[model samples]
Target: MTIATLFAAVVRAKPITGFIVEDDPDRPQLARSIGLLHLTMMGVGATIGTGIFVALTTAVPEAGPAVTLSFVIAGITAALTALCYAELASAVPVAGSSYSYAYATLGELPAFLIGACLLLEYGVSCSAIAVGWGQYLNELLAITTGWHIPDALARPPGNGGVVNLPAILLIGMCLILLLRGAKESATANTVLVFAKLAVLALFVGIAIAHFSAANFHPFAPKGMVGIGTAASSIFFSYIGIDAVSTAGEEVENPRRNLPLAIILSLLIVTAAYILVSIAAIGAQPWTAFAGQEAGLAVILHNLTGAAWPAVLLALGAMASIFSVTLVVLYGQTRILYAMSRDGLLPKLFQRVDGRRGVPRQNSYIVAAGVALLAAVFPLDVLVNLTSMGTLIAFAAVSIGVILLRRSRPDLPRGYRVPLFPILPIVSAGFCAYLIVGLPADTYALFAVWIAAACVIYFGYSIHRSALA
Candidate 1:
């Protein structure tokens, strides 16, 4: 068949309506045992890791004390995009997230592209979190024993290290848990989420005691351009807020819970981030924060003149990174499950391990790929790529909300974005602005990624799609 014919068939076969149908015949049935609290915790689990642990150090020096302002900017962007996501989650209430949203409103081609972007967004983000986890693990070890894993083993080769063994190991452990089942993964995630919060709270409290106004003297040292750039980087931290929306099909009373989880989680994370940024800046000059690895641990060591606080922060980082990996990995598997069910990918990915009620084969494939990337790739590059994909997906969702309003006015939307076209339009514009602010290298990478995705869809996805 011609490429156009194949694409059209795929689009027709799995029309957006397929997502709204109550039961999907080809997909495995997931238990709706997760409640609002669990979902909220999941958001916390996914979001609290890299932004606070690693990105803050990178951001503080760039924006100085104005890094707090960057957090607000990132939060606003996340909140706006989340509002659009809330409506879509409630409207579709499916597992595929933006992929499902695109399927419902745009068409199969757009849905395929969204799915491809999400693959990079979720899978690579997991790797990035694992790398961050390794840094913390090394800090914890050094604090406890006065020794660390060799620098070569602790970092990726490109970063002047022989290998990132800890990152790969962490990803492996999370993979096993994910293969076990969703409920188990969620429970584990909930515990880690609380641990991360507790440690961060402790950091905030202790760091406050060392507060020095001198650090705030040159607040915006890098100026407005620096603030904007840092905001773009910190924006990656908010990527996980949408994990709530991905759980829509499994959420109880999605209409209420989906929006609640997304908004409430955003608020909680943003508040914690702002407080942490303020505390960190207050504790030391912004220049000291530059290029500082294991930032929280360093702060603790400086504050108490003891290794205990650093140890605790390190332990927390380990748990935080673990939880982040689990949730992001879970998201990647489910999105692939959705695609496979729609016949856009190998049917093997749709196979649910009946005992675990999870997509076992898909988990293995994703785990292998993510683990490889975690071991060999530089963390910064992976993070920026993830941010780029997410920004595009967020922008698409915002536009989708506006398009759906006009095209399917009669459809019952559980939650509507406030102010309709205006809200979604603003949300789209904000995401686009962030995208533009990304470095030229990021744009180059994104272009290549999208081009590869389009090629894959035309060559394989279109012809094999269930709709075709």
Candidate 2:
């Protein structure tokens, strides 16, 4: 068949309603066991990492105390897109998240592209966070003792070091947990989430003692451009807010809980981010945050004049990064599984391990690839690329909400976006503005990635797609 014919067939494929998966229907049964609390914890597990712990340190120095305002900007952008996600997620109530929503509303080609963009967003972000964890762990160890891991073991090449052994090891550990099953992985995530939160609370509490109003004197020192730039970069920290939407198919009372989880998670996380940023800035001069690793640890050391708090923050960061890796990796595998079930990719990706009720092979494949990237690549490059991919996907989902509302008004939606066209329009505009704010090279790289994805869709995905 011609490519156009294949694309049309893929687009016309019947929507698979409910949790039934024909090829591996057993997977849905495996998934249904996950409940609302576990799903919310998954959001907590993923949302609390890198952004608050690391990104704040990086962004605050650039935006100054107004980094608090950047957090607000980023939160608003995420909240708007998240609302659109809630409506689509509730209406579709499917396994794939945005990919599924795009397929149901846009077309198969769009779905494939969305899936590809998500690969960059989730998979690459996992790698980035893992690398960030490595840096903090090394710093934590060095602080406790005068000695540190050799550059060869803890740092990537060309940064005056070799492979990041700790990062690779962390990714591998998360992979094993994920292969065992989602419930087991979620349990571990819950524990880590609480530990991380407790440590952050300690930081906030202690830092308050050192807070000086003097820090507020030059709050907007960087001006509007600085705040906007930092907000765009820090936007990566808010990426996990959509973790709730991804679990829509598995969520109980998704119509109620999905919207609740999305909004609640965003609110809690945003509040935490703003509080943490303010605390960190207030405790130390904003200029000191620049180029700092394990920044929370450094702040603790400066505040208490003791090593204990820094050590605690480092330990918390280690656990937080591991949880982030597991959740994001899990998300990537599930998205791929959804695409495979749709026949947009090879069926091998959709296969589930009957005993574990997980997509074992796919999980392994994703983990291996991400681990390598984490071990070898520089994190700064990976994070910016992740932000680019995420911006495009977020923009698409926001626009997808509008298109669906127009085309499928009769479709049952559990949660409607508060303001139909206006909210979605604003969401899309916000995402677009963030996308434009990224460095020129990031935009070029994103273009190349999307173009490559289109080529794959036409050359392979379109022809092999189940619908075709």
Candidate 3:
């Protein structure tokens, strides 16, 4: 192959219209019973957990009481990419999410790399959240009962012990719920979403009563750099807002509902995060947050002089994080299923159970892969991978929005990005800034992964893809 031929092969793009397809009966046929409510809940359930539930300990110290502002800065950054997702999801409405958009608007190689990013964003994040779930479960256990899971079983390899039993068990349970079908899984997630919200409301209701204006003094004690860095760290919490786009096939009124759900969920999540951050910071001295893993619960415990509050918060974290793991894992499977259907992956991944209307094989494969990751790897390594993959995938989607607008303006969009070319340009640029801000080690690993994905695309995906 000459350089020109290889370049042509790599840049070949897919048709920029229609739902998921090659106009073949053998391809997947997903049921569309999910309404706007469930789709929005899917986004909320995926977004509102680990970052708020666990990461505050690290974030608050960086900015003092102004970590609340960090949440806003982080949210604005997420909102930019989210607008891109909203516009693309409205226009495209495919289960492949950003990857499908890239294939249609960018090129096969970019699409393949976006697919890789989605795996890290969804699968690795799922593993990391599940690890969080295990920790909180142990917290809940120790608070409610006299005992907790042994470290030998609870900790992941190299972190402390042989394996993470509780994390895998959490994934196993979610797998069972998912195999029941999409509607059922969404229903379960909806319930969990509400449960966690009520728990958060309880925390806020109690904590806000003790709000001291004095605590917010010297806000941004470490200044704007600290706030920005904290925002970068907590931006992962804003993820899963795009998880709504991954369920395009399973959603009713795809164009309207997908975009509506994505934006609405982000709005809801940002509001909740800001409210919680304000309440937590106002109720306690900023210096007191440095090492409190259960910060919010500790706030409650301090206010009421009780252990029950911490136990309840622990229960909430466990349930809420379980929902995060479930939704993200679900997103991962649907993405691979789309890749397989497009011939970028093995056919086995696209195999759907006709009776269940779910890609059982894809779900099982993703769950098994992530469960193993959760059981063996510690959370520290996984967190940066999630952020890097997430930002790159988001950046690609922002770029895709501009390209698609220029290439196919004739297509009716359910939601047009408010500011047109400028919004998409800035969205992509912000994503680039965040990606560049990631640690050097993270950048090196991300480059390696992209390189490897390019090899797979050149050696296999290029030839295998019908769309390419």
Candidate 4:
């Protein structure tokens, strides 16, 4: 191909309002049935998983009692990006999350690249949370029945054991629910989110009753450096806020519900995170947080010598992680469906079940991919990479907001980011700053994933693109 032809093929942008072409009878379109409540539940279900439940062990050790400060910093960064995402979702309501926004604003090449980054964010998040579910399930079973799942069944290869059966089983369960339909899945998620919140509230209530002000001494023992690093890590907990946007096509009244869900999800999750961090730190010395496989349960165990609180925490965690896996898996399948519809991926992803009005095959494919990772990879290996991917995707959405504002000022936006370009600029900058704090290996893995995506784009997608 000539240089001009190559540039034209790669840089051509999709129209912001043209993502869903539902006129064709044979074409499978996602069903729009989710209301505002369901959308918020999705955001909640996807956002509050392993990050708060399992990550405290690592985050507390890094920042001591001031990990609460880290939670605030991370929450602020997420709020900025969530606002940018809200504007984009209102302006260009589509199924693919930031990838679709990039396609409509930044062109096809960037869309393909952003789509790959989202795979890391959502896909790895599903795996990591499912692995966490395995640990919590073991704890619950051990407490209730005196029999824990063997390490060979509970752990992944890198974690010094065989396949993680419970993790894979959890993914399979979610796959079945998603294939059933969006409403069923949404209802299940809503129930799980409330249950998860109740358990968290119980923990905070109990922890506060035992709050020892002395445990907070030397609050910044590790200094600003540690707080910043811990903020970067805690950022993972905020990953699912964008899942609200990913369901644009499936939501009722997309323009209105999308932005409301995004904002509320951010506020709710952030407040819970800050409160939980404070209660946990105040209840016990920060030093006690490290090396606990299930941090919250361990905290409860310490506080009440009775095993019941720990058992309750474990049961709550199992339900919480299950919801996370379901929502993250749902997000990934919807994104892939959008990409496939645009001819950037195989047609298989976009195929919906006629009776159910949901993408059964796509859900299965995503579940298998997530299950493989959950069965093989260790938790730490999956967590940092997910944070790196999320930071890049957040930056892309922030930049897309700015670009869309400049290019399509006349376009009707249901929600506009206040202060013009300021929010988008700050959001992008903050996300980039967090990206830099990640381990170098995470960056290298991201580079490899994006490079592989580019190669696929050139080799197959370019020739078959719908725009072509």
Tens-place lDDT digits, model 2, residues 163-248: 99988899889989998887888788888878988988999999998999898779899899889888888787776765666665
lDDT of 1: 0.84
Q: Which one wins on TM-score? A: 4
The lowest-lDDT stretch of 10 consecutive residues in candidate 1 is: 7-16
Candidate 1 Cα outliers beyond 4 Å, as residue runs: 1-16, 22-27
Q: Per-residue lDDT tens digits of candidate 4, residues 1-468?
A: 999999998899998657645446777567899999989989989999787898998899999999999889888899999999999998888799999999998899989989998988999988989999988888787777889889998999978789999998999899989989998999999999999999999999999999999999999999998898888877888987878888988898898999999999989999989999899999989998887788888788889987899898898898999998889999999999989999999999989898898988888889999999999998887888989889989999999998988898998889999987888899999998788778888878878888899899999999989889
Residue 12 displacement (Å), model 1:
4.9
Candidate 3 lDDT tens digits, 252-306? 9998999889989999999999999999888999999886755676678789888
Candidate with best lDDT? 4
Pairwise lDDT winner, candidates 1 and 2: 1
Candidate 4 similarity to native, TM-score: 0.98
Give each model's clash number. 2, 0, 0, 0
Give stretches of model 4 more than 4 Å off: 20-22
Candidate 4 residue 418 Cα shift, in angstroms, is 0.5
Stretches of model 3 off by over 4 angstroms after superposition: 18-23, 26-28
Candidate RMSDs in order: 1.8, 2.1, 1.7, 1.1
Residue 9 of model 3 has an lDDT of: 73
Give the 10-residue window scoring lowest on summed lDDT in candidate 4.
Answer: 16-25
TM-score of each: 0.96, 0.94, 0.96, 0.98
